[model samples]
Every structure is written in structure tokens, then in C-alpha cells.
Target: MGRWDPDARGRLERAALELFAEQGFADTTVPQITERAGLTTRTFFRYFADKREVLFSGEEELRERFIEIIRTAPADLTPVQLIRHGLEAAAETIFQPLLEYLRTWRAIVGSDGALRERALRKQELTIEAVLTVLRERGTDEPAAEMIAKLSNLVLQTAVGRWVAQPVAERPLVAFVEEVFEQLRSTVAGEPVHR
Candidate 1:
């Protein structure tokens, strides 16, 4: 079994998703999540602090996982390249189930303003965490943060579309690379000063 289990996290995650879907994230309670998970309220509290936290339950774990992967990545890789490599490794541990949760996450977030804000907050924190790792590896702050934010965007877009794609043929890493290429092309059209 992977260090992170789809089954165990899924239990809590799915419980939260259902309650948020049915009763709303704001309306749901911690007790209800425990009840749905067939676990204790203390257990629920052990894993999550409140109903809103369920959406972010895995964020820290996966962020640290990816950061470790990046820190240990080979020396010669470029920042974008290393991020890509780290993402591939992290995907094995991170992406698949997150895609599953995002479907429900998207629905709930779309319906509620507070949930949307929370989701944005989580994304910002994730980008900040990634940037911190990059800085530790000696990357400059602004560039590292920009790339991290862009990488995150690719992951979210890919995961959101992966299951919904007509062919379901593109790899997630490929999607990130594709996005980078598109952005590169967009920038290429700008007039050069030098």
C-alpha cells in the first residue's frame, strides 16, 4: 500500500464531500463527518478540524511530498524541468485521488462563495509552500513563485480535465508541458526591447 491510502483518506474525504454537497460546507458539522465515516468525533478531529478543512485535508501532505521530491531532484535540471520531474513523482502519490475529490470540490465551491474563497486560499498556500521549497534550493523568490503558481495551474487544469476528456489520452505531465509551451508562445509575440 502507498504511504497515503486512497481508502482511509477517501473515507473521510467522501464523508465530507457528501455532507457538503447535501447540507453545504457551512451547514455541515464535524460530528456529521465522523458519523458518516463510522468513526469517532475525536477521530474526525484527529484528521480534520472542521468541515471546511476536509477539502484541504491532503494539501499539506502532498505539498511536502512534492517538495521533498524536488529537493532531491538531480542537480542539472532547470527550475521548470525539476518541477516537472517532481510533479511526476508526486503524481504517483498525489494526483489521482485529488482528481476524484475535485469533482465534488468543484460542485460545492461553485455553489458557495465561502467555499470558493477557501479553495483559493488553499491554492495560495500551496503555491507559497512550493515557493518556499524552491527558495530553499537557492531559487530566486519572484521567479520561483511564478513558476510554482504556473505549475499548480497546470496540475489543476489537467486533473480537472483528465477524466472529462473525450480521448482521455494526454498525460498530466504532458499537459503541464503543453501549458508552458503555450505561455511561451504567447510571450514570444511581445516586442523585444533589447
Candidate 2:
């Protein structure tokens, strides 16, 4: 592969994840990632600000997708239903194909305090974006905030389970629906089915 090769960003991401997994996040460097990808240091910088950006570069796009999902959801849906709809859509469209990448990214982020904090910050920004969209759609502030937080929980839990499951055992959307069902059961004072 050369710098002009297709999927330079994808190559860099894969190379970074491999290096991070083998050498640890703190031990990985831009030159090593670029070398592993058969890309130049300049090509790596073209796609990311730093090595960390390789892991988190999709967050802004994800936030935008979430906002779009909320903005376009059916007006008749209750707050919880609207959130569920958005989360399921995101799971199918944004996360389902990235299970392996996300599992690797999650492990690398978890091993480093700063990376974990960065991931949390990105999640918070996404939640804030969803909250704003919900409020714009006329949900009350308190309800919007709660729904935003709950949606994050559902997304994280669903993605966690989806990544942990054997490939083809279940779709990410199923996990999202399951978590929502559990949330509904908990709120209704019914026994959650685990």
C-alpha cells in the first residue's frame, strides 16, 4: 500500500488499533502507525490530528446522525419512544458494522485514564447534541435531559453486549431494543427479564 492507496483513513485506523493493542496506547506512536499502514506520516496527519483522533474521529459524524434521527422521528412518539427510535436507528446505521473496531477501541480507551476521559467527554458532547435536538422538537428541558442520558445508557449497554456476543449471534439493534425493554420494565416496577 502506498500513500495514494484507497482507504487511507481505514488503513490508518486499522494500523493504529493493531499497534495500540500490541504495544499499548501510551507506547504507540504516529510513525509506528503510519509505517504499519504503509502510509506516510503526512497521510496520517491528513486524516487525524493525532493518534488519539484515529480512535475517536467518527464521534462528530455520530452526533450529527443522532440529531438527524431525532429531528426526523415521528411527531406522535412519546419521549421514550422517540429516544428508542433514534438509538435503534443509530445501532443499525452507525455501530453495527463497527463492532470489531469498537471492541478494540474500547479496550484501548479503557486501559488509559486520559483516553477514557476523552471518550466520556465525547459521549457527553453527543448527549448534549441529542438533548438540544429533543428540546428543539418541543420536549421539556428536564425530560429532554433525562431522555438524553437514558439514550446514552441504552447505546453503551447495547454496544457493549453486541461487541461481546459471537458474530452473527445478534444484531446491535436487538441489543438496543432489549435494553429499552429493560428500561421500560424498570420504570414500570416490573421484573426485568435480565
Best by TM-score: 2
Error of 2 at 165 (Å): 1.7
lDDT by residue (1-194, candidate 2, tens digit) is: 45267799988888999999999999999999999988899888888999989889987887897789889999989988898889888888888887788888888999999999999999899889988888889999999999999999999988888888766588999999998888888889986465
> TM-scores for all candidates?
0.75, 0.90
In order, candidate lDDTs are: 0.73, 0.88
- Model 1 is weakest, by summed lDDT over 10 consecutive residues, at 1-10
How many backbone clashes are present in model 1? 0
Please identify model 2 stretches exceeding 4 Å from their true place: 1-6, 166-168, 191-194
Candidate 2: C-alpha lDDT: 0.88
- Model 1 vs. true fold: TM: 0.75
User: Model 1, which residues run further than 4 Å from truth?
Assistant: 1-10, 163-169, 190-194
Instruction: Give the per-residue lDDT of model 1 (tens digit) for 56-146.
Output: 7776877777778887888778877876787667655666555556566787887888878887887888788888878888888888988
Q: How close to the true structure is residue 1 of candidate 1, measured as C-alpha lDDT? A: 24
Top-lDDT candidate index: 2
